[model samples]
Target chain A: MQTIQTIIGYLYYAIAAVIGIVIVANFVRSRDVRKMLLYAIVLSPFVLRVLRVK
Target chain B: MADSKGNSLVIKIVVVALWLALIIPGGRQLAAHRNYEEAVVLGPGVTEVKKLSDWAPYVANTPNDCSIYVLDSGVPGGSMLVIGGTHPEEPAGVLSAVTIVENVVPTTGKIYVAVRANRSASTVTRPGDAYPQFFNINTDFGKRTFRMGDRWSNPLDSWPDPEVYVHYPSKQLLAYMDVRNLNRTWPGRPDGMITERTTRAFIDMIKAENIDIFVDNHEAELEYSVISTIVAHQAAADVAAMASMMLSAGEFNMGMEFSPTLLHGLSHREVGDHTDAYAFEIEVPEPFLDRVRGITDEALLLEGKDEFVMRAGQAGLLYEKIDENGWNIHERVGRTNSTIDMIVQMFAMFYPDKPITYESLPMRNDIVANGLGHYLLDPAQAEADRVVYE
Candidate 1:
């Protein structure tokens, strides 16, 4: 059971990492200022979570 | 073309810088709060300090494997267990238990106190509630700061909350986040979430220690109906009622209520049903938790003073009364301590054979007069071995 929970925890972090990568890619590609700002706001949490900062 | 490219580069740098500005300090603060430890000076009565995992192995490596302070008299009598920080937002409860650990010594039977019953909850403050990460109390030596925490266990410790929480055994549905609420996860399962396992560890300890009286301390918002009362299980209703009556007649206003039978996840209900112990929960008023509260900060948290809460009382919207004095930390902790004292006194009267007696604990009036800080011992002055971190 502990093993399963650990796996699930890692999976959540992996999902965050994936989302962060996607956001960064989109952020760099997007030319719209409003869209870039929105992406930055959305990406901040994922970045922190992936980094295990929060 | 050159100007357009330059503008794009500048915008990218600005966006990145903004993101860094948002997360850098916030992340650092969160990390510091998570890692900070509160100091506790073990009193003369503390014979041993055991980990919660000592009784239940399932919580051995978890964040909720909190310390259990055992104070045994060696004389044969009844045993009691008092737990605080079941809801970490309630600072008074934690401080009350700390006072017990630092000051009280049982004369007969044994006593076990958990100053931070739900340690994981104490690690994080409520998000977006603007809760102060910590609050400080002045002591004779200097000041002692304690983490001001959230009601539920940190999501970092127990994440991916279920869409709905179906309580074990009873199958009662609770709000999803309550799965991480220590109070709501009583009679917990070993294989369940971290919070559930923590409670299970406590329940195991209760059984192992042969705890005769079980007390869980808490504080509630003035608007909440359960404030300033002792909510007891039917097994402990008589003791609670007598204590409430006596305290109100003598020390302060206190009410008694029966734990609702249908309330599936509460400590007062579940712990009593599952164990031999008579379970009682004491709640004092905390204006900081009220929806009508002003400025969410340490001053409001400790002083419990707020004009907005007073206005709510004026409108008769509050279940508990408050004035300019409000319900300070000292009052809340003192009342809780007194209630615990009264409950044990009444319990002994009903069952002379299982008498749990203790001494040197400051009562409500003493605390109110001299102040709560007077009771808190300076760790710096204490012997190195006598100090423990919670």
Candidate 2:
């Protein structure tokens, strides 16, 4: 159970980092779409957790 | 296009979930710590321990009910009242008074120490500020836990602030939320708000006990101009000046300023004007209270180090100095304790008839060396009758 939890934690961080990089890249590329992407990235985890999709 | 839209929605949902996961538990942890309690070890000098309600019965059984520790020198010359926790978030005030109760042994005059002047405020933490619920200081026996309190009395204790707070007697209009500020409710009314009644009770205690000097302990943000200064009422200006000069020469840097005459509800002003006792308030610099503080946690609260606050100090925006060493808890408490000692000594010199004397209180150098926790006695080791909780 502990090993499983550790693996899950690493996966979570990896996903978060990837999402963060994507949002930042979008922000540098297009100003108009940046806010939308940032908002989506910021809010996505909560929507997933609330819907029990994870 | 549809796939992209779907993906954006999924991302938004995931981010929101992560935010909630962090926030919900973080808030709970903070709330859990808020209930920390500090034990007050009645020292050798404590002759009696009483409740605030004993002076004013109206506050009995209420959350505002606080403890009053009396240290009487058998050969008493004068009586002094030291109030702490007026704004509970200012831990130095409360800690200094607690140190006195735990260490001081009056040899000439009587001393009354109130560790929690506003008990209700100490029970609650500031909202949205992310203030730690509790902090601990290491001691010989073990660590002592103290609640990280709020500036105002908890709304749970006093609800629905008035649209405009009209101070009693003076009828001066103040901010609505100030009704919960004990400092602004000085010379309090018995039939008025809880904070007002608490102050009223203190006034009653002062008058009944014939207190010669009333000292209110406080700490100010580095941004505030009055940091590391003694604000004296008109009557106590001479004593304050003498104390300030002596402290500046002998110990730490300190200044004396007259309390604003027009400032209503403040203890330094109202307590002096209404009562016979000379009133003064001492303020030490606490960088943790600054707006530009980085992390609002126990480490910053105890160590007083914050990068953002230091940056502000570097820019010359702060009235007080701040560095990596920061303004640690010991320094703040040491300044307050030393100032109190200086004030009492000065008062004794000025009015030889009303001489208040006490010893065994650690001075600035001693406190800075030994740390504030060194002066604090472990309540668990104290006699059951001598242990009190604040």
Candidate 3:
């Protein structure tokens, strides 16, 4: 049960990190200025979540 | 580009899951801490514990019914009533009253303290502000939890606000929702709204007990012109002036202003007009209540530090100063306690025939040094009969 719980937690984190990276990459690759800005704003909370020290 | 659509779908699913994961825990934590209760340890000075209903039976078995703590000196001279939590969001007021109830030892006259003046308000939180449900004050025993309450009576208790609230007796028009505000329903009607009934019960208590001085504790938004001042009724102008002068010399800079005669519902105006007891309302600066405040949370509520509010202060928008050190809970509570002491002293001096004296109340410097928690007692360790909930 403990191992299963640990595996589930790791899987959740991995999925979240991958999605965050993809979102950031998409924002960087976007040609339309408005779309890029929108994506950047959308991804800001994730960046804040990752960078939060406390 | 071909695989982008599939990838986007996967990412969207993951993001939603992550959002849910974050929200569920946060929501559960908030729910768990929502209904916080503070313990009031009856100190050596406390003679008896009574309910608001005991004085006026109209509020009996109601959520608005509050605890009345009596610190009676056997050799009596005069009695004073200290009301706290009329607006529960102004926590410093309530905490100061609790500190007095748990620490003060009256030597000459009696002190009546209502820690949660608007008990119904304490059960609810400010909507859409993301206000923390509870705040903890560290004490000798452990963390003492207190409810983070709203300014007005909870909607669950009082609802369906009139299109325009006309002040009873005076018939002055006020904002509709202010009907639920305990502060605005002062010198209230017995058969009116819940807030009005509560205030009526208080007035009854005052008249029945022959309270000499009535001190209403409050905190004001920094943007308000009345911030960091005492509003005293005409009858209590001399006492307020003397107290303000003495307090300014001894402690913090405090000013006194006469309550507006036209203001119908306010305690400073109505209580004095209706009753013989002198009424004075103290306003401490609270940055959290300011419109320009950033991130309304427990840390900001307790420590009172807000960069946005500080920026507003720099722009000359605030009535009171705000900086990094901020207006801390300790400082606000200290100012209030000291003001109360000064007011009581002034009252005693002005009306020597009706004297109210007390000792062992932690002073401004002491509260600032040791913090508010240092003065509060642990109710768990107190005698079973002595521990009463507000």
Listed models, DockQ each: 0.66, 0.03, 0.02
Candidate 3 C-alpha lDDT tens digits along B115-216: 999998887776478787888888767888888889988754564466898888788899998888998988888777788889999999999999989999
How does residue B306 of candidate 2 score in lDDT?
92
Which regions of candidate 1 are displaced past 4 Å? none
Superior candidate under TM-score, 1 versus 2: 1
**Lowest lDDT 10-mer window, candidate 2 chain A?**
A45-54
Query: After TM-score superposition, what is the CA distance of residue B317 in candidate 2 from its true location, in Å?
Result: 1.0
| All candidates in order of TM-score, best leading | 1, 2, 3
**TM-score of predicted chain A against the true chain A, for each candidate:** 0.93, 0.58, 0.67
Most lDDT-accurate candidate: 1
Q: Given candidate 1, what's the lDDT at residue B46?
A: 90
Q: Against the unseen true structure, what C-alpha lDDT does each candidate score?
A: 0.91, 0.84, 0.83
TM-score of chain A, cand. 3 = 0.67
| TM-score, model 1 to reference | 0.97
